[model samples]
Target: MKLESYVKLTFLSLSLFLLIACTSEEASKNKTEEPTKQSQTEKKKENQTSLKENIPNAPTNTDELIQYPGGKNAGKSIGILPEDEKKQVHKDLDEFPKITEDASETEKELYWNNLLYLFQEDYIDPQTVLEKWKMESFGSPDIEDPRFQFKENLNVEILLDASGSMNGKIGGKTKMELAKDSITEFSSSLPEGANVALRVYGHKGSGSDQDKQLSCESSEVVYAMENYEENNFEEALNKFNPSGWTPITLALNEAKEDMAEYNGDQNTNIIFLVSDGINTCGGDPVAVAKSLADSNIKPIVTVIGFDVDAKGQEQLRNVADASAGIYANVNDQKGLSEQFKSAQDIAEKWDRWKRDSLSDLDAIKVDRNFMILAFSNDWGRKRDKQNSNLISASDYLYYEKKMITKEMYNYLSDKRDEQKYLTDRSQEEVVSYLESINDKTYGEMKKSIEEKYKQK
Candidate 1:
């Protein structure tokens, strides 16, 4: 019985030892397999991250990939593909022939054309390539003394359209409201001695066939020709609301009469006609504008078509052309305000000119420097945008869509870098040219800069 018990104990110990050895072997196998699996996963993630690192702020989706941050398409998408078309595009890209250095010119052209076709939405127009380098004309620089001076008193008359369409909304505010605010700001900021007048048209009757005659004849000077008075000007603006048919002809005719006393010889007359539509009343505005231009008033009529339709713009442009003036079409409140700001700048320059009869050489130099800085900044922004867009597009094509081979993507990237280098050199050259002419006389500087950049 002792021998049998010892034998049973030995058998039990051997069985336990075998069980422990099997468990240890299983744990070791799991540990070895687990590291191999984890390594594969980490390697895959590292490869993806490295690919994405090619583009700064790399887009994860096609929508973000095609959106442009600047250029003429600002605030808008560069390209948007429908689902079916996108699938077809992916297939085409997958089968696209690779570009090679030893390829014939025609083959190379075809390959590049196909690639560029995919990104045609981001194509920059050659005509507008150097548009930011274009200089703005401040005043007549050819004169012996380039000063914004007027020998006579200045008269600024505003013919504001109170037609029903002025009630239209832009950016949550009525066109009339925006015009009133801008006009108020403009008049208040004018030179102290300048005479200002406010006239309202189509403010008397409702915009109905029954009241068309009254509306057509409704043109009156709400504020007489005098220096700006805040309370009086605000009261005059409050007296009118958007109403009645547009009687542009009658308004222009009445404006001639209003400024009949302020002839061009004694007063530098400037008439700003703000309208949203063409003349609804049957009258000849172009003829009237010509008459006003020919009269002793000799007013420079600047017709501002505030959100005017194409047809209305044409007629308004004709009126301005007849008067030997300018036409400005404003789409929003901001654009309208910018137009007014231009006039305000003129007023300020006029005041300065009156105070100082001679040219402000220091002011001219500062203005030139500011223009140069603006040009440089604009060029840099465009360059960076172009480079970022190209890199993002390449990454999207190569990794996300698997459309292009690695070699092709690398070639494209190298070409993009080269183009960026060229543009950088061009920007530096242009900025250097502008700096070189910083101290030149106004006429000489204007001529040199315009001649150089206009051709570009």
Candidate 2:
């Protein structure tokens, strides 16, 4: 089978399995009716909060349980084209004059409207213009294709600054504490298959000159790169305290070796180097960054200046530029959280776009099938009415001892044939237009993803 067919078949099977499971669960619950009814009665009473009638209810943790006001009315009220508008469209199509080469703008518009009316009859709306606008408004999220060689597991190494400055307060908490909170949330949100590691610098000694030597050499892989778990990560965060001088260069160099085993074009390696000050270890960080950038691991190093001074930011930016990475500056706890959130948001957005696009494609096909079914029903009704009229006329003629003329019978038969021909031709046109739009839609989606994320 073709790849597309295989994918669709797999989805259909999964959907069927879910449906059966739900049906079985419903049946099992129906067998225990008394307890279920009693629990539901009590639950409904407990849910009464006396909120304003006009206010929309808040969505629950599981969105499926939230009841929107108006129920079925909510769905019935919304449409791309209203029922009255659809009737007007049909009326206009029937009355509009045929087009000419020298037709006025109004006539030309009517001609186009008639075509649109026919297409809409099949529930197909050509939305290339709207799609283009959407592409312009939101651009596209970076999405890496799974078919590419870059299919190996993701590896992220966070080089956190544990220098003395991190002990400083931010929004009633130490900077270290804020970083921990943001990182925890970030880690929790990452997709399950990712491998994560934590490296901390300057957590061994005081910032005083006496402890400078120890601090400079304090960069360590406190947690090696491995599948992340909440408890282990929390424990790792608790083990470190901010006390020593900053040793950013050492951190960068260590990160290279930490990810050396996973080096390849197939795997993605990323580094988040967070610091609040310039390197004080008297080593060349820019040169170290350059080396890491040129390593086999090919890490994308993002240097984050966490509430740094102007000079510190400039130095950090230089290191980022040297490594061909991006530099971001965050000043407070909120900024820190947002920066971390953005990292996860990028991945989430790509997944969302793909899923939504697939749903839209399926909806288009479903609408097409529904349109065909409706058209067939309409044709069946006309056929049955024509046959009934013919039989009644023949019976009346027989009762009067007279026969219907052959010419009249042939004319009626021809009308039925013409109706069938018109229906089939219009159906063909609708299907052809839909196929073209579907092709364009898929192309646009592919371009959106490839243009943003496909690696050079």
Candidate 3:
């Protein structure tokens, strides 16, 4: 009976030992798992905090900040929309080509984010940009002498059209006689030492079909370009008789040759083309004028349409415009004198501008340069901010199981494009102005002459 009791006690001790081993193993498993669970919880909280910090606060009044007014969803948020639906909306908004087909969705998203910032509806005001531009200096120093001294070797050529049209009567006197008288008087009023030449066209043939070719080719420098001589000019005036086709092109070509001896920047050459009709010859006067203007002599070619019709005016005007010259219209001798006076005034104004306007032009150039720099720098800063804001907003929406609408992205993109266009245009305008300063001033001078002398 005692042996049986000892065996039962040993079995009870083995069972206690097995129970303790199982408890220790269970405690070790719990200890290992607790840290992993706590780590996961901490990571999730950190992600939430970061997302909240990244999201920009919604504007109190978007109407003033955003540019999309009266849109169907202008002020509405699309954060609650499904991702697929948002993508479809974006597809609908797509107009111009985006990056490329191979671009990943992340890249596309980044591009959109940039657009949102750059083209925000309410952006940096243009006036603000101007202010910033005004504050900077472009480093254009003043010149000791901006005045352009006039070159004294002045040569003037009078190209008179002696076609049959000039035989017409004005105030009971033949147009030719009146023109000759006017030329004589005008020459007497010119400044001393001025070289002058007389050219005549259409003085060799009758205005008939049989003589058309000869008349068209008839042009002569009756008085070669030289110092003004009253007797020689009078002889030249009386030599031509009006009775043929108007060979305006031939006349201009001959006049150009007459000035070959003194055609250069060291001298100022001017052509006064007096015509009563269009070029009857199959010649391109406009082309001739352009060539003359582009020549080394580069003489100023002013056209005086004497009692011409609409067609003649158009032709003459085109010649003047092409040559960067001026057109004047006159009916009688009195009008002719006034037109000549206007020419004198224009010359004076041109000289004045050359002497005094260089400083003004320099200032304008400096201002334009500063403005361009300001515009470019401002554009970059604004674009970066816009992109950053868009990225944060997009991330926030993604974390919240929301999405940005295609319309929003498209609007931003359009705005960004518009700003870019504006910046480009601003730069282009300044550059163009700088390049055309001299030409523009000359144009103004010509315009003034035309307006003052053109027939009412």
Residue-wise C-alpha lDDT for candidate 1, range 1-456, written one tens digit per residue: 999999999999999999999999999999999998997666444333312122223222222222211221121112343445345445645555433333443433344434433332221221122211111233335333212225457788999999998987655578899999989988999879988999999997889999999999999999999999999999999898998999999999989999998867666677999998899998899999999878988776778888775467679978987886666666556657766665666666667667876445566567657767765675576567556655655676778776456766776777666656666676677678768876665557556755765421
Please, what is the whole-model Cα lDDT of each candidate in the order they appear? 0.66, 0.58, 0.57
Best by lDDT: 1
lDDT of 1: 0.66
- Say which candidate scores most in TM-score: 1
TM-score of each: 0.54, 0.46, 0.46
Prediction-by-prediction clash tally: 0, 0, 2
Better of 1 and 3 by TM-score: 1
Q: Clashing pairs in model 2? A: none
Runs in model 2 with CA error above 4 Å? 1-150, 346-456
Per-residue error at 289 for model 1, in Å?
A: 1.5
